[model samples]
Target: MLDNPQLTQTVEQLTAVIRLTVPVSEISHVMGPAIAEIMAAIANQGVDIIGPCFSYHYKRPSEIFDFEVGFPISRAITSIGRVKNSNLPVVKVARTIYHGGYDGLAKAWGEFCAWIETKSLNPQESLWECYLVGPESGPDASKWQTELNRPLND
Candidate 1:
Protein backbone atom coordinates (compact mmCIF):
# COMPACT_ATOMS: atom_id res chain seq x y z
CA MET A 1 0.00 0.00 0.00
CA LEU A 2 2.90 2.33 0.80
CA ASP A 3 6.65 2.40 0.76
CA ASN A 4 8.76 2.27 3.94
CA PRO A 5 7.86 5.36 5.94
CA GLN A 6 10.65 7.79 6.79
CA LEU A 7 11.15 10.69 9.16
CA THR A 8 11.90 13.92 7.32
CA GLN A 9 11.56 17.69 7.29
CA THR A 10 9.78 19.83 4.76
CA VAL A 11 10.76 23.28 3.53
CA GLU A 12 8.06 25.92 3.78
CA GLN A 13 6.45 26.81 0.46
CA LEU A 14 4.20 29.54 -0.93
CA THR A 15 1.00 28.48 -2.65
CA ALA A 16 -2.30 29.61 -4.15
CA VAL A 17 -5.18 27.69 -2.63
CA ILE A 18 -8.95 27.33 -2.49
CA ARG A 19 -10.13 26.42 0.98
CA LEU A 20 -13.11 24.09 1.24
CA THR A 21 -14.97 22.45 4.07
CA VAL A 22 -17.07 19.75 2.46
CA PRO A 23 -18.62 16.43 3.30
CA VAL A 24 -16.52 13.36 2.54
CA SER A 25 -18.95 12.34 -0.22
CA GLU A 26 -18.60 15.74 -1.88
CA ILE A 27 -14.79 15.72 -2.12
CA SER A 28 -14.57 14.14 -5.55
CA HIS A 29 -17.18 16.52 -6.95
CA VAL A 30 -15.22 19.55 -5.78
CA MET A 31 -11.57 18.51 -6.26
CA GLY A 32 -11.35 18.90 -10.02
CA PRO A 33 -13.13 22.22 -10.25
CA ALA A 34 -11.18 23.67 -7.31
CA ILE A 35 -7.88 22.66 -8.86
CA ALA A 36 -8.86 24.11 -12.23
CA GLU A 37 -9.86 27.42 -10.67
CA ILE A 38 -6.58 27.61 -8.77
CA MET A 39 -4.57 26.74 -11.87
CA ALA A 40 -6.34 29.34 -13.95
CA ALA A 41 -5.69 32.00 -11.33
CA ILE A 42 -2.03 31.05 -11.10
CA ALA A 43 -1.66 31.11 -14.87
CA ASN A 44 -3.30 34.51 -15.06
CA GLN A 45 -0.78 35.87 -12.58
CA GLY A 46 2.11 34.13 -14.37
CA VAL A 47 3.18 32.34 -11.16
CA ASP A 48 5.52 29.42 -11.60
CA ILE A 49 4.05 26.22 -10.21
CA ILE A 50 6.84 24.42 -8.40
CA GLY A 51 5.03 21.32 -7.32
CA PRO A 52 2.13 19.01 -8.05
CA CYS A 53 -1.39 19.47 -6.66
CA PHE A 54 -1.82 18.75 -2.95
CA SER A 55 -4.48 18.77 -0.25
CA TYR A 56 -3.59 20.12 3.17
CA HIS A 57 -6.15 18.83 5.62
CA TYR A 58 -6.53 21.00 8.71
CA LYS A 59 -7.72 18.19 10.94
CA ARG A 60 -8.45 14.49 11.04
CA PRO A 61 -11.40 13.88 8.74
CA SER A 62 -14.66 12.41 9.82
CA GLU A 63 -17.99 13.54 8.39
CA ILE A 64 -16.34 16.66 7.03
CA PHE A 65 -13.06 17.54 5.37
CA ASP A 66 -11.71 21.00 6.07
CA PHE A 67 -8.79 21.52 3.73
CA GLU A 68 -7.10 23.57 1.06
CA VAL A 69 -6.23 22.38 -2.42
CA GLY A 70 -3.36 24.04 -4.19
CA PHE A 71 0.07 23.88 -5.80
CA PRO A 72 3.38 25.18 -4.50
CA ILE A 73 4.36 28.36 -6.33
CA SER A 74 7.68 30.08 -6.95
CA ARG A 75 6.52 33.32 -5.36
CA ALA A 76 3.60 35.10 -3.73
CA ILE A 77 0.47 35.75 -5.77
CA THR A 78 -2.52 38.01 -5.33
CA SER A 79 -5.90 36.62 -4.36
CA ILE A 80 -8.11 35.86 -7.36
CA GLY A 81 -11.67 34.64 -6.99
CA ARG A 82 -11.64 31.61 -4.69
CA VAL A 83 -7.89 31.34 -4.88
CA LYS A 84 -5.72 32.98 -2.24
CA ASN A 85 -2.15 33.03 -1.02
CA SER A 86 -1.34 30.31 1.49
CA ASN A 87 1.59 28.18 2.53
CA LEU A 88 2.81 24.79 3.63
CA PRO A 89 4.91 25.42 6.69
CA VAL A 90 8.16 23.69 7.47
CA VAL A 91 7.70 20.74 9.81
CA LYS A 92 9.01 17.37 10.81
CA VAL A 93 6.96 14.60 9.24
CA ALA A 94 6.53 10.94 8.60
CA ARG A 95 6.43 10.58 4.83
CA THR A 96 5.75 7.76 2.41
CA ILE A 97 4.52 7.21 -1.11
CA TYR A 98 1.28 5.28 -1.53
CA HIS A 99 1.44 3.21 -4.68
CA GLY A 100 -2.11 2.72 -5.94
CA GLY A 101 -5.32 4.49 -6.97
CA TYR A 102 -7.07 7.09 -4.86
CA ASP A 103 -9.59 4.58 -3.57
CA GLY A 104 -6.82 2.88 -1.57
CA LEU A 105 -5.77 5.97 0.34
CA ALA A 106 -7.72 5.22 3.49
CA LYS A 107 -6.13 1.79 3.83
CA ALA A 108 -2.72 3.22 3.11
CA TRP A 109 -3.15 5.83 5.79
CA GLY A 110 -4.34 3.20 8.25
CA GLU A 111 -1.30 1.08 7.62
CA PHE A 112 0.95 4.12 7.89
CA CYS A 113 -0.50 5.22 11.21
CA ALA A 114 0.03 1.74 12.55
CA TRP A 115 3.69 1.97 11.63
CA ILE A 116 3.98 5.32 13.38
CA GLU A 117 2.43 3.83 16.49
CA THR A 118 4.91 0.99 16.42
CA LYS A 119 7.71 3.52 16.27
CA SER A 120 6.18 5.54 19.14
CA LEU A 121 6.05 8.69 17.08
CA ASN A 122 3.74 11.56 18.00
CA PRO A 123 1.67 12.75 15.03
CA GLN A 124 -0.26 15.95 14.63
CA GLU A 125 -3.95 16.07 13.75
CA SER A 126 -3.28 17.70 10.39
CA LEU A 127 -1.95 15.90 7.34
CA TRP A 128 -1.37 16.43 3.62
CA GLU A 129 -1.20 14.37 0.46
CA CYS A 130 0.71 15.34 -2.62
CA TYR A 131 -0.66 13.93 -5.87
CA LEU A 132 2.66 12.99 -7.41
CA VAL A 133 1.18 10.98 -10.26
CA GLY A 134 -2.49 10.39 -10.91
CA PRO A 135 -5.13 10.09 -13.69
CA GLU A 136 -3.38 12.70 -15.82
CA SER A 137 -0.19 10.67 -15.73
CA GLY A 138 -1.52 7.44 -17.22
CA PRO A 139 -4.34 4.92 -17.53
CA ASP A 140 -2.77 2.35 -15.19
CA ALA A 141 -3.88 2.86 -11.61
CA SER A 142 -1.05 0.69 -10.30
CA LYS A 143 1.48 3.19 -11.57
CA TRP A 144 -0.04 6.15 -9.78
CA GLN A 145 1.75 7.49 -6.68
CA THR A 146 0.51 9.76 -3.93
CA GLU A 147 2.95 11.19 -1.41
CA LEU A 148 1.44 10.94 2.07
CA ASN A 149 2.79 13.21 4.77
CA ARG A 150 1.79 13.25 8.43
CA PRO A 151 3.42 16.02 10.39
CA LEU A 152 4.99 14.90 13.66
CA ASN A 153 4.93 16.78 16.93
CA ASP A 154 8.09 17.24 18.91
Candidate 2:
Protein backbone atom coordinates (compact mmCIF):
# COMPACT_ATOMS: atom_id res chain seq x y z
CA MET A 1 0.00 0.00 0.00
CA LEU A 2 3.06 2.24 0.49
CA ASP A 3 6.04 2.73 -1.73
CA ASN A 4 9.69 3.85 -1.41
CA PRO A 5 9.75 4.17 2.35
CA GLN A 6 12.78 6.27 3.31
CA LEU A 7 14.22 8.64 5.85
CA THR A 8 13.84 12.24 4.71
CA GLN A 9 13.70 15.82 5.91
CA THR A 10 10.43 17.68 5.75
CA VAL A 11 10.76 21.29 4.68
CA GLU A 12 9.49 23.73 7.28
CA GLN A 13 6.11 25.13 6.35
CA LEU A 14 4.05 28.12 7.49
CA THR A 15 0.41 27.18 7.50
CA ALA A 16 -3.16 28.21 8.16
CA VAL A 17 -4.93 25.56 10.21
CA ILE A 18 -7.81 24.34 12.29
CA ARG A 19 -7.01 21.85 15.04
CA LEU A 20 -9.15 19.45 17.02
CA THR A 21 -9.05 16.27 19.07
CA VAL A 22 -11.47 13.67 17.80
CA PRO A 23 -12.07 9.98 17.90
CA VAL A 24 -10.97 7.88 14.94
CA SER A 25 -14.59 7.42 13.95
CA GLU A 26 -15.23 11.18 13.89
CA ILE A 27 -12.16 12.25 11.92
CA SER A 28 -13.92 12.45 8.59
CA HIS A 29 -16.79 14.47 10.00
CA VAL A 30 -14.47 16.90 11.77
CA MET A 31 -11.85 17.26 9.05
CA GLY A 32 -14.20 18.07 6.20
CA PRO A 33 -15.55 21.27 7.72
CA ALA A 34 -12.23 22.25 9.22
CA ILE A 35 -10.49 21.97 5.87
CA ALA A 36 -13.24 23.91 4.12
CA GLU A 37 -13.13 26.67 6.72
CA ILE A 38 -9.37 26.97 6.45
CA MET A 39 -9.47 27.05 2.67
CA ALA A 40 -12.23 29.62 2.59
CA ALA A 41 -10.39 31.81 5.04
CA ILE A 42 -7.21 31.61 3.02
CA ALA A 43 -9.08 32.47 -0.15
CA ASN A 44 -10.81 35.42 1.46
CA GLN A 45 -7.42 36.68 2.58
CA GLY A 46 -6.06 36.29 -0.96
CA VAL A 47 -3.13 34.13 0.07
CA ASP A 48 -1.69 31.54 -2.23
CA ILE A 49 -1.40 27.95 -1.02
CA ILE A 50 2.19 26.87 -1.39
CA GLY A 51 1.61 23.16 -1.06
CA PRO A 52 -0.92 20.41 -0.68
CA CYS A 53 -3.16 19.96 2.36
CA PHE A 54 -1.65 18.21 5.39
CA SER A 55 -3.29 16.49 8.34
CA TYR A 56 -0.89 16.52 11.27
CA HIS A 57 -1.53 13.96 13.96
CA TYR A 58 -0.15 15.01 17.31
CA LYS A 59 -0.77 11.79 19.18
CA ARG A 60 -0.73 8.08 18.51
CA PRO A 61 -4.15 6.63 17.80
CA SER A 62 -6.37 5.43 20.63
CA GLU A 63 -9.98 6.42 21.35
CA ILE A 64 -9.02 9.97 20.41
CA PHE A 65 -6.20 11.84 18.67
CA ASP A 66 -5.18 15.44 18.18
CA PHE A 67 -5.11 16.49 14.55
CA GLU A 68 -4.70 19.60 12.45
CA VAL A 69 -5.85 20.01 8.87
CA GLY A 70 -4.25 22.81 6.93
CA PHE A 71 -2.41 24.05 3.89
CA PRO A 72 1.05 25.50 3.48
CA ILE A 73 0.91 29.22 2.84
CA SER A 74 3.43 31.56 1.25
CA ARG A 75 3.43 33.71 4.35
CA ALA A 76 1.80 33.84 7.78
CA ILE A 77 -1.49 35.62 8.01
CA THR A 78 -3.96 36.80 10.63
CA SER A 79 -6.09 34.15 12.30
CA ILE A 80 -9.66 33.75 11.11
CA GLY A 81 -12.17 32.07 13.41
CA ARG A 82 -10.85 28.57 14.10
CA VAL A 83 -8.31 28.91 11.34
CA LYS A 84 -5.01 30.01 12.83
CA ASN A 85 -1.39 30.48 11.87
CA SER A 86 0.97 27.61 12.61
CA ASN A 87 4.33 26.28 11.59
CA LEU A 88 5.45 22.84 10.60
CA PRO A 89 8.95 22.21 11.89
CA VAL A 90 11.77 20.86 9.80
CA VAL A 91 12.26 17.29 10.96
CA LYS A 92 13.55 13.93 9.87
CA VAL A 93 10.76 11.52 9.01
CA ALA A 94 10.11 8.01 7.83
CA ARG A 95 8.12 8.79 4.72
CA THR A 96 6.21 6.82 2.15
CA ILE A 97 3.59 7.38 -0.51
CA TYR A 98 0.33 5.49 -0.24
CA HIS A 99 -1.73 4.98 -3.38
CA GLY A 100 -5.28 4.13 -2.40
CA GLY A 101 -8.39 5.32 -0.62
CA TYR A 102 -8.16 6.95 2.80
CA ASP A 103 -9.84 3.89 4.30
CA GLY A 104 -6.67 1.82 3.82
CA LEU A 105 -4.47 4.40 5.55
CA ALA A 106 -4.23 2.47 8.80
CA LYS A 107 -2.69 -0.48 6.97
CA ALA A 108 -0.17 1.80 5.25
CA TRP A 109 0.72 3.38 8.58
CA GLY A 110 1.16 -0.05 10.16
CA GLU A 111 3.49 -1.11 7.39
CA PHE A 112 5.48 2.12 7.65
CA CYS A 113 5.80 1.80 11.41
CA ALA A 114 6.97 -1.80 11.04
CA TRP A 115 9.54 -0.67 8.51
CA ILE A 116 10.76 1.96 10.95
CA GLU A 117 11.10 -0.66 13.67
CA THR A 118 13.02 -2.95 11.33
CA LYS A 119 15.48 -0.15 10.71
CA SER A 120 15.79 0.50 14.44
CA LEU A 121 14.59 4.03 14.00
CA ASN A 122 13.24 5.94 16.94
CA PRO A 123 9.99 7.75 16.06
CA GLN A 124 8.02 10.53 17.69
CA GLU A 125 4.29 10.50 18.32
CA SER A 126 3.69 13.36 15.91
CA LEU A 127 3.07 12.46 12.28
CA TRP A 128 1.47 14.03 9.20
CA GLU A 129 -0.04 13.01 5.91
CA CYS A 130 -0.02 15.18 2.81
CA TYR A 131 -2.81 14.51 0.41
CA LEU A 132 -1.28 14.90 -3.02
CA VAL A 133 -4.32 13.86 -5.00
CA GLY A 134 -7.84 13.64 -3.70
CA PRO A 135 -11.52 13.93 -4.62
CA GLU A 136 -10.76 17.25 -6.28
CA SER A 137 -8.56 15.46 -8.75
CA GLY A 138 -10.94 12.60 -9.57
CA PRO A 139 -13.34 9.97 -8.26
CA ASP A 140 -11.00 7.02 -8.52
CA ALA A 141 -9.88 5.99 -5.05
CA SER A 142 -7.12 3.82 -6.51
CA LYS A 143 -5.40 6.92 -7.91
CA TRP A 144 -5.47 8.97 -4.75
CA GLN A 145 -1.95 9.66 -3.48
CA THR A 146 -1.07 10.39 0.11
CA GLU A 147 2.34 10.94 1.61
CA LEU A 148 2.58 9.46 5.10
CA ASN A 149 5.27 11.04 7.25
CA ARG A 150 6.27 9.80 10.67
CA PRO A 151 8.57 12.15 12.53
CA LEU A 152 11.82 10.77 13.91
CA ASN A 153 13.07 11.34 17.44
CA ASP A 154 15.68 14.05 17.60
- Report how far residue 133 has shifted in candidate 2, in Å: 0.8
Clashing pairs in 2: none
Q: All models: lDDT?
A: 0.95, 0.90
TM-score of each: 0.98, 0.96
Worst 10 residues of 2 by lDDT: 59-68
For candidate 1, write residues 1-154 as lDDT tens digits: 7999999999999999999999999999999999999999999999899999999999977899999999999998989789999999899999999999999998999999899999999999999999999999898999999999999999
lDDT of 1: 0.95
Q: Candidate 2's residue-wise lDDT over 20-118, tens digit each?
A: 988888987888889889989999989999999998988767789788889999988789789999978899998999999999988888998899999
Top candidate (lDDT) = 1
Looking at model 1, residue 70 earns an lDDT score of 99
Clashes of each: 0, 0
* Clashing residue pairs for model 1: none
Cα-based RMSD of candidate 2: 1.0
Best candidate, TM-score: 1
